[model samples]
Target: MRQRNKPWADDFLRENTHLVIPSPSEHRGKWQELFGNNNPIHVEVGTGKGQFIVGMARQYPDINFIGIELSKSVIVTAAEKVQDSDQKNILLIQENAENLNEIFMENEVSTIYLNFSDPWPKKRHAKRRLTFHTFLKRYETALSPKGELIFKTDNRGLFEYSLVSFSEYGMLLNEVSLDLHKDHDPENIMTEYEEKFSAKGQPIYRCKAVFRGE
Candidate 1:
C-alpha cells in the first residue's frame, strides 16, 4: 500500500527529535545508556503505527523498546502515538531494517520482532523479505547469544518461508503457532494489522526462534 505523503512530516520529525531519534547509528551498542538503565532492549523492525511497541513498553516497563520504520509520514504518526503514550522506555527510528547492523552491535539486542511485514511475494523479491538470510544474518549479529526472533503474520506463505529460512540459517524454533489467536495467549500484544486481520477470522501464525551461534 502506498503511503499518503504528509507535507508536515519533515517539520514533525525535527520538532519531535526526542521521540523519533535522529542519527540512530551513533547510539549503537550503547542503547542501554540511552534508556538510562541496564534493561534488555527489544526492537520492532516494521513498527507500522507504534501500537505494538507502545503496548509492549506499557506492559514491560523494565524493557526498552525501539521501533524502526522507513516511512517519514508513517513514522510521524507512530511518533505522535508514542508522545501521547508518554512512555519513556520507547523510542522511534526513521530508518530501514537493512541497517540493523549499523544501528546495533553484536549482542546488543535481546529480542527482535517482525510483525505483519510485507510478504514480498515474488521469487525475484524474496531477498527483500524480512526473514531473508541476509536480514537473519544482521539479526544474529545484533542480538545476544540467547536472543530471540519472534515473528507474527497472517500470511501463511511468508510464515512457511520464514520457518524454512530460519532452519536453513541454523536458527532453532523454540515455539510456533499456526493459530495464535485461537491459542488465547493473555500476554500477546496485538499490532494494528494483527487486530484488523484476526477480526476477519484469519489465522495468525507466530514463531519464536533463536540463532545457533558458531
Candidate 2:
C-alpha cells in the first residue's frame, strides 16, 4: 500500500530535531558516543511509524536503538512518538537501507531487524527483496562478528523465500515460527502491521539468522 504524502509531515520532522539524528554517517563508528554509552546497538530497517522500536527502547534502556526509514512522511510519525515519550536511547534516521554499510561502520552494529518488509513478490523483482542475496551481502558487511538479523512478516511467500535465501547465504537460523501469535510471547513487541494482521487472525512468521562471516 502506497502511503499518501502528508505535506505537514516534513514540518513535524523539522520541529522535532532532537528526536532524529542529523548526518548519521558522521557518527558511524561513534554511535555509542551519541548515546554516551558502550551499550550494544540494535537497528530496525523500514521501521514504519516506529511503534516496535520505541517499545523496545522503553523496555531495554541499556541498548541503543536506531530506526532507519526512508520516507519523511512516514518517519515523521515515528519522530513524533520519540518526541512525546521519555525514550532517550532511540534515534530515527531518514535514509535508505542500501547505504547501511556507509551509515554504520563494519562490525559496529550488534543486531538488525527487518519487520514486515516489502515482499517484492514478482520473480523479476527478487533482488529488491530485503532478504535477497545482494541485501544479505550488504548486511554481512555491516554486522558484527556474531551479529544476528531477526525478521518478521505476515507474508508466507516472503517468509519461505527468506528461509531459502538465508540458508543459501550460509547463515545459521534459529527460533523459526510460522505462527508467532499462536504462542504467547511475553517479550514480544508488536509492530503496527503485526497488530493489524494478527487482529484478523493472520499468523505471523518469524526467524533469526546469524551471518557466519564465511
Candidate 3:
C-alpha cells in the first residue's frame, strides 16, 4: 500500500540532508571514501520504513550500509529512525533502483538486499519485478565480483518465480528457506513487513544468489 503523503516529509528529508547522499551519481566509485573508510558496503533497495537496514547497521558496524527508497515520505521515516540512534554507518538515498548502475561503480558493492519488494503479480509487469533478469543484470553490474543478492518476500508466487529466474541467469543459489521463521534464525533481522506478516503466520521465503563466475 502506498503511504499517504506526509506534508512534512520533504522538509524532514531536507533537514536531515547530512544523513542522505543527494547526488549519488557523483559518488559512484568513491563510496568508500564517502564513509571515510574502506569497509564493505551493502545496499538495500525498496527499503520501506528502514527497519531491516537500520537493524543491520546496528548489528554490523564493520560494514557500511545504504538504504534506497523511491518515496520521500517512506525514506523520511527511515531517517527519523536513524536520528534517534547512534548508528553512523547507515545512509539513506532517495533514488530508484533502476538507475543503480549510475549510482555505483562496478564491483563497488558487496551485497544488495531486497526485502518484501512489490511482487508485480501481473504477467505484463514481470519485467518490473526486482528479481527479474532485467534488474538482476543491473545488480550484477553494480555488485562486486563476489557480491551476493539476498532477497526475502512473503509472496509465494514471487518467491517461486525468483528461484527459477536465478537459475536461468546462471546464479548459484543457497540458503533457500521456504519457511524462514519456522527454522528461527538468530541472525535474521526482520523487515517491517516481515515482522507484521510473519506474526500473522505468513510463511516468509528467503534466498541468497551469487553470480556463477564471481
What's the TM-score of each model vs. the native? 0.99, 0.96, 0.98
Which sections of candidate 3 miss by over 4 Å? Answer: none
lDDT of 3 by residue, 96-201 (tens): 9999999999888999999999999999999999999999999999888889999999999999999999999999997899999998899999998998999999
CA lDDT scores, all candidates in order: 0.96, 0.91, 0.91
Clash pairs (backbone) in predicted model 3: 107-144
RMSD of 2: 1.1
The count of backbone overlaps in candidate 2 is: 0
- Per-residue lDDT over 1-214 for candidate 1, one digit per residue giving the tens place of the 0 to 100 score: 8999999999999998899999999999898998899999999999999999999999999999999999998899999999999999999999999999999999999999999999999999999999999999999999999999999999999999999999999899999999998999999999999999999999999999999897
Model 2 Cα lDDT, one tens digit per residue, 68-163: 999888898888888777789999999999989889998888899999999999999999899999999888888898999999999999999999
Question: Considering every candidate listed, which one attains the maximal TM-score?
Answer: 1
Candidate number achieving the greatest lDDT relative to the actual structure: 1
In candidate 2, which residue pairs clash? Answer: none
Distance (Å) between predicted and true CA of 156, model 3?
0.4
Task: List the RMSD of every prediction in angstroms.
Answer: 0.6, 1.1, 0.9
